[model samples]
Structures are given as structure tokens and as C-alpha cells.
Target: MTANSLELNPVATIQSPFKSRFGIPRQSGLVPDAIGWIEPHAPWHRAEAWAGIEQYTHLWLIWQVHDRPHQPVSSVRPPRLGGNARLGVFATRSPARPNPLGLSLVRLLAMEHQAGQVRIRVGGLDLLDGTPIIDIKPHIAFTDCPPNSHSGFAQNEPERLRVDWSMLPHDEALRLNDHQRLVITQTLSLDPRPAFHDDPERVYGCPLFEFDVQFRVENGTLFVLGLNPFP
Candidate 1:
């Protein structure tokens, strides 16, 4: 048997508030307030390259799930299924695939065209900070959304956990700006804890933006413990 392989270079990189792998909404748009910036590499960073891109409201991002292990696999346990059942790798959006590539559809918020570079601000991203973006394309609804689509076992989104900020101080919560607060609230509502574990007493910490957002879960409720500066 013969083998063929191809190489690809990252076209851009993203700057996201998801400082670590923990707590990123499992799926894009789950946290509409979660934001990120995409900047092209040297050859393509020129403003002229991004001409007319602002007209579109959404985009498709093809990137590398750079932080996770991607050893070849035939099946993966989906978190949405409580990680109990195994599904073929092709059927799941797990990063542990042969290629470790990720595809996301995100909303484009704004575009900044500087003298030499183009900065694109996008929202509803579910990726790690500094993720390598392999490709970017405008999402054309007419072609991207096919008629009568079926989502299989992942048809509907998982139920969100109710976030309780009572455990956190009013002054501490007040310190965060509107966008920051929204990001924290929306991110925690997705319940980023490991799907296999449901220990109510377990304390978890997620590094979001400039602070360490810590919390716990109990009875379908998520309680924010505190927000400490990143040391």
C-alpha cells in the first residue's frame, strides 16, 4: 500500500479569554459573550487582504485542537453523554481524532483594519487562548445551513446549570466589567467539570481572562466561590 500526506501552515492565531482548556463552553455559541480575536500571519496580515470581510456576521474557523492528545482512535466518549457511552470518532466532535482538527462556527463582531494589519474580533468562540487557526471563511447561511438537518444524539444542547454568585462577594463581582461578568456567567452555566464526575463538594477553578474563576456545583446549581487575580 502507498501513503500520501499533506502539510498545512497556520494562517492565523486566536487570542481568547479561555486561558486554559478548562471551562470552555463545549460548543461554540453556547456562551455568546465569550470573545476572541483572530489575527493573520505575516504574509496575510495586510489590511488589504481582509477587504469586505466585515459585511458577514459569522465565520467558520478551522483550527488545531493544539492542547489535547490526539492519538488515533476509532471511538470517543462524548461529554454530552456523561462520557459513559462510546461513539465512533467520526460521529463525535472530540479532539482526540487522527488529525486533531476543530471546526467552529462563530459570530463576527467587528473588524479593525490598521495601516499594516487587520484585527478581527469574533464572539461565541469555544477554543483555548492562542489556538492556531488553519483557515477562516465567511459562513454563508444559504449553503452552510442545509434544510431539515438532523443532529443525531447531539440533537439538542445540554441543559445549562444555574449560576449562583452569592458565594462570591458583591464587591468582587462588582469589580468585573459587564463583558467580563457576562463571560464568567455564561461560561459557568455550561458546567465545565469532567462529565464522569459529579462530586458536589469538588472545587474547580477555571482561568478566565485576567482572573481565576473558582466555583462548585450542587443540585444543578453552580456557585461562584471567588475571583482571584492571576499570580
Candidate 2:
């Protein structure tokens, strides 16, 4: 193993629906409909290397944190400041700096070419299931579109967390489908949690299959009372 000590592996591996990473939403297209897939590995699953990548709509993951745990930080303590502020891990994105490498842009919801393998069904992912794909650039809206990008020092922009679909459960609104009921009502109206972890007598829970919807967030909105569906 010496081609400069080769070992970069993961050509692809994210299949997210975010099975864990506790309430994911740390940033990444902010849940335009959190869904994911990208399983290319093995001879790069050639199909001419996924020619034209479906006329791009967005794609630029370069993931690899495989579940962190390699610590040796440069500075980090940003759970959006609930971790007691202490930035400087290249100004925060902190997966524990020095190369935990994770950058997303997502949203290209289709592309499968099995038989030589190649799948890619992304959508605003925040990465969490398997995560490993170490490169897949494409989002080039004119050199990474930045028509006035500047949020240095993280200028405040948090205010959206109101979701009350009449306290859900008219048979769970007939099992959603209008884009998953508008992405679960805009992901619980953006209260993905993390402003010092707001807690109005907390009660958040999220799992839906055998049911477990019990949410709560008062004032900033997000209240779905009823339906433990047996959990």
C-alpha cells in the first residue's frame, strides 16, 4: 500500500433519513426535504462515471466522519453555542477540525443505474446514515453561487419553529404525501432545536412507523399533541 500510502476509500456511502446524530439539522440546505442516497463504490460503479450527473440541480458532498471519534481538536465547542461558545475550528462547522471533512450542498433527487451500480437520490441532506462519500462535486451555479454571502461571526438568523397541524392525527392525516406533507410541515417549522436548546418543559420525540410523535416547543411553536401510536 504505497502510492503515497494509499487509503482514501469511500467513494460513496450516505443513505440518510438520518437514523441518528440526534435531531440532525445542523445545516445543509436546511431540510429541503431530508432524504438521501448515494451508493457508488467499486470500480467507481462506472456508467461512464455517471455522465452529466442529471443536469445538476445541486451536489457537492465531500463527506467522511464515519461517526467521529478521532479527537485532537484545534478549537471547538459549537453546538451553536449551547456548548458554551469557543469557536475557531476554522470559524466553526466543527466536526472537530483538522479534517473530519463534511461539506454538503445536496438536492438532486434521482439517478440510479444499477448493474454496474450507481445510485444518487439526495435532497438537502444533513448526513447521518452511513456517511462516508468523500467527494462528488457539481453544484457550480457560477462558481458556487455567492450573491452576497457573508454570515461571519454567525450573524443571528434563528426564528422559525411553529408547527401545529391541528395537533395531528386524523389517521395521521391519511399518512402524508404532498411531498411528505410538505416535508413534515417544514421540518417542524424549523425548530430543529439548538438555541441553547430551548425547553418549555421539553418533551420532543420523533419516530414514525409504530408512532411516537409527541412533540412540544411552546411560544416558538411546534406542538403536536396526540398519537403515541403505541411506543
Candidate 3:
């Protein structure tokens, strides 16, 4: 088939909590709690076919790079090195590419139909809100899970940032469930930032709900001053 004939139009779009790409996790599986929904176009809304999809733990999402504005290229600068180092586009998960496609393996929560419209509730999405979706596929553990995967050039486990959760108010701490609490703690601990941008004096902020969490890491621990819920 010719290139023009192989072009695939989006069948759906994802509505996610992620309004901006700034704070999204570099990888999807890293944030299993983040939720989103997929709304399929009119032509493909057959509720019966998607029935029992909640029985599965995860689903594979084939989505388009709606946020990518530049032309696709064969090489890119990975964020890991503060975008100073160049690597083959295929080696890194850069959004800019020939196809501008994104593949994410996310947890399926539920499916809802309204007015003949089918929506899929999912978790651990890295895409921004209204991201165009090309297709959906089931994630088979037996076939998709590769136990002996190698990292190749992406070796060297990065060090985690330290966080002091004890400083949080009792009421605020109690508001989060065990899973949310753990995820929040773990995510902050990773200190997801450019490797070369680490500076002791630098402070970072992450918007959570109505608050902006300002923190810094020192001595392998993250220190939280207080919460500033954004307006």
C-alpha cells in the first residue's frame, strides 16, 4: 500500500485531567492513579462489543501526537539530559516523529454509554486532554509482558528525591487513601526532572487538586514547606 493509503484517521479522543504536559509523568505506568476517558466517534459506538472490558486489568491505547507541532525527524534530544544530548528518535519516546503516534499501556477502569456514545474510563494516561486516539487493543500479559527486558543504553538506575511527608497536616494527610498516598509519595520521591538541571537551591512545584505543592530534596529526602492550592 502507498503511504497516503496507509494513513489512519482518529476514531476517538481522550479526555484526561492532564490539561498541560508539564507535570505529566515521563512514562505512563508510573502514574497508575491518574484517570481519563476515551470517547469513540459516532461510527464505532457499539456498546455490546466493548462489554466486559472491565474484566481486564490493562488496555493498550494507540493515540496520535496531537501536541507535537514540529515535523517528524529521525533523531531527538532526550529530556533525561536536559535536551542537550542527541539520540536516535527511535531510541527515545520523543513525541516528534515520522508518525507522531503514541502508544500507552493503561489500566481500564470501566465503560459507560450515554446517548449512544461510548466512553472508556482508563488510568495511567500520559496524554493531555482531548488527545486523538487511533485505536484500542487489549494487553495480554502472556504475550506483552517480557520478563527479561534489557535497558541497552538506558542503564543506571537514577537516584530518588527524598520527601518528608510527616510535615503535612493531619487532616490533609488523612484525606488521601492508602493508594493515593503511596503514589503521591513515590512520584515525588522519583524527583522527575532533567538530570543535569539538579541544583540544591532549586525548588519545584507540582499542582495537585486545588493546591500547589512546593518542595525540595536534600539528603535523599523531600522537604515540603506547605501547600498552595492553585486558583
Candidate 4:
């Protein structure tokens, strides 16, 4: 390591229900009911490092795209445009970047310290399980949420599809609570499918908590096919 070239070490790792990248939301806070946590590593494991963090309502998580290798490229496709348009890497929030770093604003739910271990529970996890957390900062509304900001092509959040759970089978010991059900609903509404995929006949599965949610999209409405224990 050199003075000019900095190396980032993870302060913690995220514990999320999203076991894989296939069904995770493209962005955080999209599914407000989704719950996750951050477990501090050796150096940051002390409870003193997380003291008073509960006072804040939300926090900014600086993480990395550890699941995939970095693709060296100047331009990439934004999924919002159906993966048809190419833009500079910096212009889009794609994980295939020079550093593979990512930032997310998540709502803080609770903080717990048990036996010298500190765990911070959060909501709206778009990250995969065991993803490294580089840094954490409080979200300042005045600075983070600037007024009249122009987001170029992504001026607004993606459109949500209607989720239908009427077809989900009850024989599978369906024991999802209200929030868990809402998490599924909100997750599916964001339409996790790739922008290029438009096959209404195709079925997709997303693992949430302990169950695998199966579904398909037809006529703009997403239908819940069934649920199986995550394998």
C-alpha cells in the first residue's frame, strides 16, 4: 500500500435476506419493509464504535460490489433504459465500475449490543447477504436530499408493477407476517427482472427471508406463483 493509492477495508458486513443478486432491489429504500443488519468486523466490532447511532433515523451505507468482478469500461448500460443505451460509467450507478463501490441510504430500525457484538438493524436492503460495508454515515436531509435536483434520465423512481398474491398456494405452511408479506409485495412491485426480459410466460424466483417467492409478469401485473423453502 502506498500513500497516494488508498486501500479500503470493510468495517462491517451486511446481513440481508437476499441470498443472491437475482431478486434484490436495484436500489435501497425501495422496499421499506425489508429488514437487514450490519455486523462489525474485528477492528470495528466494539460497541463504542456504534454508540448513539440509534439516535439517527437513517444512515448511508458505503459498500462494494464484491459478488462480481470489476469490468474495466468507460461506458455501460443503465437498466432503466431496458439495457439498450450506453452511458459513461460514472453517469450510471452500475456495479461494474473502476472501484465497484456502492452507496445506499437505508432507514435505521434498531441497534443491539449482545456479548461484545454490535448489530444495527436496518430497512430496505438492496444488498446481498454478506456484502462488506466500507463505511457508515448519517443521512443529512439538507445535504443528501438537495432540493430541485436534476437526475438526468433517472429523474424519478422506477415504475412499480401491481403484485398479485391470489395464486400463491396455502399448502406450503405460508407463515409470512404482515411486514414480510409487504416486503415481498414491495420487492416484486419494483420488477427485479432485467430490462431486456419481457417474456410474460417465463417464471422467476426470488429468495426472501426463508422462502423462495416464485412469480411471473403478465399484462403489467406481477402474479405470485408460489413459495418454497429457500434451498
Candidate 5:
């Protein structure tokens, strides 16, 4: 650390369907239906600071890894490598870093003023609810697009899992709105399983919007069994 290192304060808090990190997509923009918002704090909430922000269609969010509070290790086992092979921390986006920072590119959906607060709705975020956002910047297509970018060991996108909502009961199915339904389906289809485990009978639950969704994987298919109100 340098003597001149500066401190940073959260400019906003994110409101997203992912209450827990268990089911969130590994990267941003993978779940197009996953919606989220940023509620600016205090001075940042002033409308003048956000004037003309709506003109941009996408933004880059620099945020804290709120869930990764433990000390960072020099290397990590990436899930893409079957949790066996190790890689330097800098080479992987493992969330456990020396500074514990995260970056995401999300599409701006809307900007709203409710009462005295400023809310910016966004789509394609993989962030957890209440995550602290440190900064937001417009994504400039002319400068941000790089022709030399490469995926490294992650040569291709992971195969999507098959989600079968047939097991979901009528009463439970009725609880989800169209948006929530799409979010859940898209999220589950990504097979949020840890790369190390593939227990076919293990039931998992994750918070989606206002509901606690329960499901299991069987024969390579994710089955939505039920849902309960998020507590």
C-alpha cells in the first residue's frame, strides 16, 4: 500500500433480485432478464449530478465485493477449471482480490425520481442486492471496444442447463410476474452449481425478487419444485 492511497465511499446501493450470491451468473450480461437498480446516497442523489445520464444506454459500475470480506489469497481455484487447477488471483475474476472490487457493464433501463430519492434501473447485472457501488461511468463504444480482447482459459461460454418448470405447482407459478418468471428461468438455466460438485439430488434455494425459489438438478436438468415468500 502507498502512503498516498485514497479512501472511497459508496456513492449508491444496488437493489437487485440476487439477495444471495449462490445463483448469480458468473459474469454480467449473461442473465438479460435479471433487473437491478442503484439508489444514490446523499450528495450523489442530487438530480443535477445525474443530469443527461439517460442519454447513455449502458454504464460501467465499480463496486465492492460485499460478500467477499475475508482476506485474499495469492491464488484461487477458478470454477471454470473444475475447482482443481489454480491460477494467480490477478488472472481470474474470483471476487477475492487484494482490493475486493468488482466491475460490471449494465444496460440503463430507466431513471426515476421518487419522493426525494434518485433511482437508476439497470438490466444484465450480476450484483447482489444492497451491494455498495463506488462509481458509475458511461460505456463509450468508440473507446471501450477493443479488438484485441481475449477470453484466456475461458475459451467459450458455459453450456446452459435445461430448466423444467413443469414441476412447479399452479399456486406457486401464479406468484411470479412475467419479469420475475423470466429472471428465474434465465438464472436457473445457467446451472449455478459449484464447479466441484454435481450432486443430482441436492436441493438448492436462492432468493429471486420477493420469493425464495427452491429447485433441484436431476439428470442434467434443473427442476423448479416450489417457492416461498422471501424472509
Candidate 6:
């Protein structure tokens, strides 16, 4: 390895409903019902490695930025700024930086050990399915939660667009359970359309869990066209 570089191995893999990046929330902790888990690999699956871990209610996940990790960009157009102005990559949390790493604070729901295999259940996550987890750290409120922090351009949470699932057939709607419904609604509320690409007549398809979510946006409202099982 180079002097400034180091090799790292993924300790776990994330199992999340977000199959693709199209509909994932821009930030973590936005969707409370977006449940997922981290299954440790090989030697990391030992129970002793997770001793006393249940004491913490939340954790910080250090993961890879998947698709964007291989690409490099010096500047980026932030969707929060209407995608009109470009800012230095370091100024914003764009995944196209030199080191494509992502950090998310997730609520720990459970820690299970079955036959020496370990899984960490978490909620309010924004990671995609099969994302590689490099490290996990407990959330320390005393030091991590800094008061009076400025958000810069993103002064407030992204506005949620009103969603209309009326177009979905009764039978198809029944396929989604309560948790799935919340995940879908919460994911759609953020308006997953690309910032620079706003085509009211265009149909967008997002992969959520095992279903292909089809929808369209018109006049600030998102209409669910259909939900088809992933073949």
C-alpha cells in the first residue's frame, strides 16, 4: 500500500430494503421504519466481538458509497441548491470525493447470535442493500451531538412532496405490509427525481425491497403508477 493509503476489509454486509439508490433518503434517520441489519463476516461473527454492544441504543456505520466510489469529481451540484450552482466537493457530502465513504447514525433495535452467526438489527438507515460495512461505532451523545451546529445551505429538512397511491390497484396495494407502506411513503415523500432532471411526463421506476416501484411526478405531487414484483 502507498504511504498515505491503507487496506481495509468489510466486517459486515448490510441487508436493507433499498435495493437501488434511486429512492434512498438523502440522509439517515429520515425514515424511522426503514429497517435493516448488519450480518458480520467470518471471524467478526464471534459473540465476544459484540459483548456489551447491546448497552448502546444507537451506532455509527462506516460504509462504502457503492456506485460512486470509483468515480472522481472535484466539484458537484448539490440538489439542495436546486442543482444550479456548483460547489467544491469537500463542502458538501457528495459521494464522489477522493475517499468514497458514508456515515450513518442508526437506531439499534436488536443484537442476535444464532449458532455463532451475529446480526445487528437497526432502524432509520439510508444504506442500500448489500452495502459493505467497514466499521461500526457506538453513538456517544455527549461528544457526537454538538449543539448549535450550522447546516449551511441545507438549513432545514427537505420538503416532502404529497404522495398519491390511489392509482395503485387494490390487489397490488395489499402486497405491501404496514412497514413497507411506511418505507414507500417516506421514501417517495422526498421526491426521488434528480434535481436537474424534472420531466413531469416521464415515468420513474425505483427498486424498493423486492418490488419495482413505478411512479411519476406532476405539479409537485407524486403519483404511484404501479408496483410489480421483481422478476
Clashes of each: 0, 0, 6, 0, 0, 0
Which residue segments of model 4 deviate by more than 4 Å? none
Candidate 2, residues 114-228: lDDT per residue as tens digits?
6766788988788877888887988889778778888776567445676887877688677556675565556557666665767777877664323445677878778876546
Report lDDT per candidate. Answer: 0.90, 0.73, 0.74, 0.88, 0.89, 0.89
Q: How high is each candidate's TM-score?
A: 0.95, 0.35, 0.77, 0.94, 0.94, 0.95
Q: Which stretches of candidate 2 lie over 4 Å from their true place?
A: 1-10, 13-34, 41-62, 65-73, 80-93, 102-113, 116-125, 128-162, 166-179, 182-186, 193-220, 223-231
As a TM-score, model 3 comes out at 0.77
Weakest 10 consecutive residues of candidate 4 by summed lDDT: 169-178
What is candidate 6's lDDT per residue for 52-158, written digit by digit as tens?
Answer: 99999999999988755378799999988889999999888887878878889999999888987789999998998999999999999999988998888986998
Which pairs of residues collide in candidate 1? Answer: none
**Among all windows of ten consecutive residues in candidate 2, which has the lowest summed lDDT?**
205-214
TM-score, candidate 6, is 0.95
Looking at candidate 5, what is the lDDT of residue 24?
90
| Decoy 2 TM-score against native | 0.35
Locate the minimum summed-lDDT window of 10 residues in model 3: 151-160
Better candidate number, 1 or 4, judged by TM-score: 1
Runs in model 1 deviating more than 4 A are 1-3
For candidate 3, write residues 1-231 as lDDT tens digits. Answer: 695758788888988655556556677866677777888886777787577777789999998888858598888887766678889998988888788788999998888887756788998877777899898889999889888878655555545676798777777666667765555565666675555665766777765444466677666778765566554
Residue 49 displacement (Å), model 1: 1.7
lDDT score for candidate 4 against the true structure: 0.88
**Model 1: what TM-score?**
0.95
Q: What is candidate 2's CA lDDT for residue 193?
A: 61
RMSD values, in order shown: 1.9, 15.4, 3.4, 1.5, 1.7, 1.4
In candidate 3 the C-alpha lDDT for residue 32 amounts to 70
Q: Candidate 3 at residue 131, lDDT?
A: 92
